[model samples]
Target: MNFFPNFANINECLEWVKRKDLALAKMELICQLLNHPEKKQKTIHIAGTNGKGSTVAFLTSIFQNSGLQVGTFTSPHLDDWNERIKVNGISITNHEFFLISQQIMSELEGKVQPTIFEFLTAVALYYFAEIKPVDLVIYEVGVGGKYDATNVISPLVCGITNIDYDHLNYLGNTLTDIAQKKAGIIKKDIPCFTTETKPQILSLLQKISQEKQSKLCKISPAKKFIFDSSQLITNFCLTAKKHTFNLKTKMLGQHQIKNASLAVNMVLYLQKYFPQITQSSIEKGIKEAFWPSRMELISQEPLIFLDGAHNLGGIKSLIQTLKTFFPAKKPIFLISIMKDKQVDKILNTLKKIACQIIFTEIPETRRQEISKLKHNNTAKFHKITDYSKAFFSFYSLLDNQKIGIICGSLHFTALIKREFLMNLNEKLNNFSLSNHQPV
Candidate 1:
């Protein structure tokens, strides 16, 4: 795994914008030019508004522990491009990324320009085929699965987690509309799994599956999960079928149980083809799987947490999770969101749990500048100009007995994490932060 890619010095990686161009035609051309590298491995395509990353993490850990070489392609890297394309849990090395990137550049240099997402998807597929092949590829849909760049692959199994309002402009405005976009990944005769319970959304997905001749296997959680919450870890006694499994995860939200349940059923369905994946492996893999920046508690003494709850539904979950853990108090929150997101809904949802809120923008063009926001959270709202200072204030308040949480876009979470980490390495004489406590 490489810390930084070779093109880190170049501006192409970060400067490439991911806009509203959603279609498979462009990706089809790029893959044809690259000789169709996506056919290298069998795939299980996972798509959802929230829990896609965590679900991917659970499946990756389970398959890898079963002794299978797993290749996972996820989107919106928290740190860098290398974080997006990974093989067997290791990020594609800078050399590997550079090699594939050059090949892509040569093939589509001037003949046809590719979008950032398209170029990266081509690089990942090429890397998987020509560079290093794997047994399975746990591919996550970038945004709406309908015409996402990664939707080019024909997967063996398609899984759609619970769908809600998200990507309203690109996917659709209503839940049914969004569900249709995610169901686009269901291929002809492929088996599908889902945790979607909404009647309308479920009906839409089932209809798509039937039209495609695919089997939509919906996995419903037990009547309820028995939660065991300690100081830091949260465990759930999840019962599926006659057997009960003690599932443990570092994630804070109860929604993870549903995600884990979906992963469990998918592994079970794959048993005929993959005899190595067993019940014990599933239990161990899920317990150990950790997806960063999603309910991630970085420190305890000052009690700072980070969750990438970028949308209304995600924010609601974050609030509920906090209520479950810290029943009686409000946590100080530092948030940054995109300009295009539903600002009012997100803020209203947070008013219940956020004692004090600081709104700041990551240094990006799409960031929701503090001045550009139209929010209605009645809490003690403070808008800060500098993101670093916002994070600094949140950290400085750790010792005051109020908990801290960072939420909103994953990219904003990434920037704040990077800034805080960078602040840790500086000399105390130059600047001070949270009394410099170690996790």
Candidate 2:
């Protein structure tokens, strides 16, 4: 066994782990050591259990369409670390990633041991401030907002999506506790936006905002957003005040409709600073913007769809979307999950819609073990450790007229995306999928 490949090496900086302690000292220290580069950039901070990534994508598209340079940082990456950092919808190249990591390592030599999240946050903020000239930056909180490494900046506007159950160990056991953690990003005199519909969560956030003297604005869902799969392109009709526009997107799921609304409301809130953003640009951005791995379809024949719905709320939404999109057909479910997730609840939820369930593991360390999995009689549960082989078998069954959906942890979806998407394009009936964005 080998360890510590030299701290000065760029590879050492690439290490990852979910941090404990719920402390920001390491993050604050690194930010100060780097001279607080994050302060130089204007940002919109988003926190929530789900829909944060989709909301970020929508906002990024709107800003880019308005001709403003945009830099975005997100977490729990799909394939590569570079996916976590992007400017104007393009990820950082290998050279830039390595250069910045090495620079951070050099600065932190024997001084302080920052968690992987803190190190990456420092790197992203420094790059956005010093290396790239961007008009705005949009970043998502990695965990709970208060102590998350990315919470260093005082954002121009804070937007929180729906708050649900997740990270119970660190956040809390109740929704109110989780709401408090999410609302930590609300600052004094800053405008805040959210799509949280839960009355308890919303009231808690409202009280927190008032206490901090922050103006909190809640966004309601689009009154007329249409989600008919019969329509080739999914269309969203979002109205802001008196302005109404029709936007089109390939991303399905009712939750996405709410996320788009949150992003649109964020742009509206930012209008006081960046007056160039208009209704037309927002519509165009929504039309051209699509987030990968959230209700994305890869094949048209047997309707092979992949979604990264890991938690109980996300899984419930996934089941609803399935009922909406494919009302006439039942889907064979291919699923994997994380060990820390609500495993029993997740399994019970999937058992409702699945005629056949294939349980497998990804290449990540936090994956749930197959041997530890409980045998279920609800569905034909088949346990397998090799995800790639199981996925191929599922695809083969799909070719024989079986509707299928792959729903599980994002890591497993990322693995399937990196390894099987191209192979799918090669094997399918002379069709290449354009839905998959480069990982």
Candidate 3:
């Protein structure tokens, strides 16, 4: 085994973004060479078109509250690459990431060339299994579950958040086709849970689970929901496995209620293995768990929100949340989407609630051109090549009567979030300095 030539730093590892052919054989071979790190921990595998990250966050917080060591692996990090791997809500340090990468690359000895995600998956498995072992590990599927890099793990429990039309290029376009692909995580006699309620999709999932001899728990939406607009919290009651549990969460939108319910059900199902998780931990965890860039309120004075609603389904949910929370008021939207996404449908959906739209470019090759984002709608549209300039231009127009939302691609939202936080901090610092009198 030899170290990958010229791989000096973590950035070098992060630069391998080219996605290779989607197949499990390569990842299986890599795991075998690494001595089966995937099988060394209690695991829960999650796959879906959306809500995967939120469900993972809810589960992580729940297990942590139970006083168990929990490790989580999620994707499309908002800020740094290390965010993809975490133990007890703490990301892996860059030094640790580099060391692990070096070890895995040396072991492979150039015999196997893994995509960026594959390499990162290997790193996460090794880190959890050998370096920093935990009581349980939760894995989020990178793409469709059938061939996703994370599918190699035989998890104790599996969950599919919901089936929708996403990643149409790789997964099929129809809902049934997509549902089958996501249902791939179900293993023999392992209980699977989902929040998907569509009859057709549920039937397909039921068929697949029956074939695998797995019990598919179909979670219904909350029986009742109450939202506190002033505090931005939701309280709901959910019944699963003939037991009813009351849950509350800070994550906004009607969709999050379903996500939180699914997490609760999965945790309850796993109590046989982890009996330390009590109702108190589940309630506390649901209340405290938070994931950024999903209906996040960055500012309340001018009412600014940032959401990563890139697809049509997500955009529809965003629209619903806007209507429910701020009815009859149109908010200005700042949006940039990936080229591969259904740009027209997403823009059209946003138009339903947007008083104005500012189209900006994300700092990536995959971003749709600002010109293509324009649509003929009543809402005033402006195209700005630079996102910072676009944001400032939009900010100048906001007042108590006007609100703003930054959305579209998660990558774009991440960049804007950093800029917004930095700008806000600067303003606060200046305000404090002006108010101080040498005290």
Candidate 4:
């Protein structure tokens, strides 16, 4: 009878997840919002078990480099909710986000209240439409692609980065079932692209593409030419339309290079259709795009690195990149994970490379209990309940010569970054007062 609260803030939305079942409820709300007169513009829909965020970032940068104003929507913001919505790499300001939330709340006053993700996706679409300069929009599906709210966009091009076991409870238990859900983003008569596919997923893609009469472009990493890898750069190129031009990127990881190639191919598809995207623009965009928490180096003293490799596939890539980038020795790690994730797989992998493990929880209801993490061998483990304390404890144990890795979840990385910045500011202020350096 009453909806007075109407989603006050992101914290409220985070709390709402605890009460609702994650499957199909938000999808229905997205459909309702799509039926409204406010929706506009064709989107580039992306889905996968890994590399979705990085792929979206690459595409957004490419479009922007070609001088088209672009809007991008992504999920599970690493450092800020504002990171979820951006125009040309600038986050939507807090005031802007609040206004959009208020307008959506007002619109749903008498109707069914939309879920947080549904409301946010609607707000992003409405904002991008209302803004005059936006020429292209890239929407990253919040969950599995099939019923993801962003699927309402009817994208011009669809891309699946990689298929792996993830979100099994909500999507499906088997790989084929998961691939089928991801393939849902492939629209009728739209071009679809993929990178490094499995035989099972490729079969699903072939079936869906045939049914929709869509063109499917499958990419194999081994088939492509890769030159080099470093801490700051990843370089590679793919054969598209019979060209092997150089493709250099700032993002880390060989897997990311594959994602970049997929994005590059999408731009090529747009070029064939739109006739405006130049090879130069694609190169510039790929070189400039950045997604936080994927092989991000936040500190140099102790060589602190943060990655959001929450899934097994991503975790494998993260480990490979770690070895390739830092080949000297094993590093200390501060790790946390979601309660629903494959914790044992990750822990087993980590035990092999981590010299010491500091277990902490991200500030979320979905966080797994650190105490519950099963250890393969009785190696060193420190359980710190709070992220800030965990970070501090981990930092104290590290010397200037050691490398520190903080990973497991994107939210954990974001929380640690915020707290680390805050602590640095406080220490600077205290130093200034103690030395009487400023008035």
Can you write out model 1's per-residue Cα lDDT over 282-342, one digit (the tens) per residue?
A: 8889888889888887766667788999988888888888887776555888898887788
Each model's lDDT comes to 0.80, 0.82, 0.86, 0.77
The segments of candidate 3 whose C-alpha lies over 4 angstroms from its true place after superposition are 1-22, 374-379, 425-439
Q: Best TM-score goes to which candidate? A: 3
Provide the TM-score for each candidate, comma-separated: 0.89, 0.89, 0.90, 0.85
3 or 4, greater by lDDT = 3
lDDT, residue 83, model 4? 85
* Best-first order by lDDT: 3, 2, 1, 4
lDDT of 2 by residue, 1-439 (tens): 1222245655555542123233775776787777778789999999999999999988999999999999999988887898888999788888888888898888778878987888889889988998886999998999999888888898999999988999899999899988898898899999889988888788899999999999989998775556666653667687877778787876787788888888888898788889999988998887777787898887677677789999999999999877876777777878888888898888878788876788888866888888788764332677767876577656655543466888789888877877777567674444223332211
**What's the CA error at residue 363 for candidate 1, in Å?**
0.9
TM-score of 1: 0.89
Clashes of 1: 0
Can you give the lDDT of residue 301 in candidate 3? 78
Residues 1-439 of candidate 3 have per-residue lDDT tens digits of 3323356777775564233233776898899889899989899999999899999999999999999999999999988999999999999999999999999999888689999999999999999998999999999999989889999999999999988878899998888888878888888989999988888989999999999999998887785788887798988887777777788888998899988988999999899999999999999999999999998888887788899988888988888888886785568998998888888788767766778888889789988986665564343777778776677766666778877888989998999888765587574464453443310
Pairs of residues clashing in candidate 2: none
RMSD of 4: 8.2
lDDT of 4 at 266: 83
Give the C-alpha lDDT of model 4: 0.77
After superposition on all CA atoms, how large is the RMSD of candidate 1? 8.5
